[model samples]
Target: MTSPTRILILEDDDGLRTSLRLVLEDEGYAVFEASDAEKALLTVEDPGVDLMLVDLMLGGMDGFSFIARARPRTEAPIVVVSARDRTEDIVAALEAGADDYVTKPFSVEEVQARLRALLRRPTIGDAETEDADDDVLTLDSRTPLLFDAGAAVLRRGEEEVHLTQTEFRLLSVLAEHAGKVLTRTALLQHVWDQDYFGDERIVDVHVRRLRKKLEVDSANPQILVTVRGLGYRLDTA
Candidate 1:
């Protein structure tokens, strides 16, 4: 039988931690709790741990440090839970290697959905299927990007883009359908799984992250173009 999905919750708030555990356990996940970053670091040593839900404001060490430190130790996805919802906070967390972000006063349902989406995502090499047209695509009319499925590497100009699992999947889907506008609904269905609750903004966040690394200028992206109200298109022109 497949082992349970292990989830580590690092939150100083006792009440919120318990509440999150209860819901996660109800969904059949093996939940572990840590009240501080120090303890969370010890807990993260176990390679069996699958996912993490971390709060930025902890007792001792701040969340950013924990994320940067624990990231090297675990391939598990980290979902930052913070009261601060500023764009800088979100971007900082993402840059620190967080897979996703959740702000304070977030609905319990939303948190559960995000966890489900992360869990549903395929790990690096366990299960990655190829698209109908998995052939490498050219960028700028000269092959600058290379998708090596065997190595799970996406290289641009001799440098591999430091993309998380979710970012890689999203970019792959867009690249496969190069130049075609894909709606948010379609991206959610394709990348995050059809069961995702259509939180397309997650797509936007990840897309921005991808642009920062893949494009020369993320502010005015030339490759990944937004389609105003529709969605986005990958124009590697």
Candidate 2:
């Protein structure tokens, strides 16, 4: 039998942490709880931790610091659960290496759905439909940037570029529908595998992050171009 997926909950609130643990456990996940960043860091590196739900406001270290510190230790997706709903706070969490963010007073169903989506292994093309040519995605024939989906690696000529799971998935989806304008809603559905969650800025923040890594000049991107009132399109010319 397959081992259960483990999730770590780092929250200072006893009630919220326990409630989340119980909910996740009821869903068949092996849940672990931590009251602060220090405690969470103790086990965050464990390979058993498949995902993490982190609270931004903690006792000792803040969530942003925990995320930045933990990001280098594990590739497990971290979802920030906090009361801060400002766009800047959300962007800061993502910039600090969080894969997703959920404001407090969020529904259990929505949290569960987000967890499920993050846990699902997204791929550009599985073995069944994969081709030699399909393995690599390039912005242009002359460009050195390449996305090797099969290997799950992005390369710029001889150099390998590192990407977080969310960034990689976003790029994969865009590459799958190259040259097509994909609205924020479409991207959220395909990348995060969720319906409207009321914040499209999540998409914009991630896209900006991707541009910084993929484009020579993120401010004047030539590849991932934004369509004024429509959306974004990957110009793989």
Candidate 3:
């Protein structure tokens, strides 16, 4: 039998962490809890961990530092659950390696849905059918960047590129519609599988992140280009 999806919850707030654990356990996940970033780091390295829920304000080390440190250890998606609602905070968390972000006072349903969406995402080497037309997309010939959909991997020549789940999803959507400018709204719906209105910055952040990986020069991106006042397009040509 397939093992239950493992989720690590790192929050200093005892009440909130316990409540989240109860709710998540009830939903059939293999939930693990940590009251601080230091403890969470101990669990983040486990390859069995499928996801992580982290709070920014934590005793010692902070959530951002934990995420940055843990990122190289595991490919599991990290979702920041914090009271910070500012755009800068969200962007900072994403920059620090968070796959997604949730603000304080968020509903249990929203948190659950976010986790479900993240866990449902296909990982590299997952045996799954392709949804896009081309199973492999060539981003640039010179740089030799390619996204192999069936393998759930992006490669630059012989080297396999490491990408966060959210980043992969964003690239997949853009690759499926290569040469077509997709608005931030459409990208949000397709990649995140949510309306996520007014949070287009999420797309922008991931796109910037992707550019760093997919382009030789992120500052002068050609493969993934943004259209002025419109949106973004992945040029396979």
Candidate 4:
């Protein structure tokens, strides 16, 4: 059997922590709780943890500091759950190694969905099947493919590809399904988290950016190739 996904919640607020523990446990995740950065560090010592949800404001060391210290020790994805809603706060958390962020008063379902998506994401070398086209795209076998469900940092071989948040999510959805040709609408829905009234240019611009990062010669692409009149596919051949 596949091991259970372990999740750590580091929030100083007792009520929020308790509620998250209850809700996430009900969602069938192994939950660990910590009220401060100090305890969070200790909790992460257990290698079984698959992901983390940390609050930006803690009693002593803030979540950003905790992330700075903890990142070197673990490869688990961290998602910041905080009351701070400013753009600066979000940017800071992402810069500090958080894979995602959630604001206060958010729905439990949304949080759970985001967590599931992050956990479901195949990091570098887990097993993956080829699409119907018989194309097999594998992430770099040498290094772990770090993804922050909120931003795009594509690592093709040895170089890290810098991408905007939108571009990152767009590439991530495609990378997850490496050899498949995803439709424009499917990309918009899954990556943009929206369904209707979307601009196709949004997809084009991000795909261009992703290609620039993933391809050795962007002018003559190799990895992210376009299918005529259909969409795009990560050439896994």
- lDDT of each candidate versus the true structure: 0.80, 0.84, 0.84, 0.70
Per-residue lDDT tens digits for candidate 4, residues 102-215, read: 788889877887787676654533333212122223444354344433332345456665554345556667767878999887886676454233345546655776676666
After best superposition, candidate 4 residue 159: deviation in angstroms? 9.1
Candidate 3, superposed: residue stretches over 4 Å from native: 129-142, 194-198
Q: Tell me which residue pairs clash in candidate 2.
A: none
Q: Looking at candidate 1, what is the lDDT of residue 48? A: 48
**Segments in model 2 whose C-alpha atoms lie over 4 Å from true places:** 121-143, 194-198
Question: Which lDDT tens digits does candidate 2 get at residues 1-237?
Answer: 999999999999999899999999999999989998888888886544889999998888999999999998887899999999988899999888898899988999989988988887564344522442475455644458888776777888788998887888888888888889999999988888756364688899899999998888789988899999989988864
**Superposition TM-score, candidate 3 onto the true structure:** 0.90
Which of 1 and 4 is ahead in lDDT? Answer: 1
Model 4 global lDDT (CA atoms, 0 to 1): 0.70
lDDT of 3: 0.84
Query: Cα lDDT for residue 11, model 4?
Result: 90
What is the TM-score of each predicted model, taking all chains together? Answer: 0.81, 0.91, 0.90, 0.60
Q: Clash pairs of candidate 3?
A: none
Cα error of candidate 1 at position 81, Å: 3.0
**Model 2, residue 138: what's the lDDT?**
59
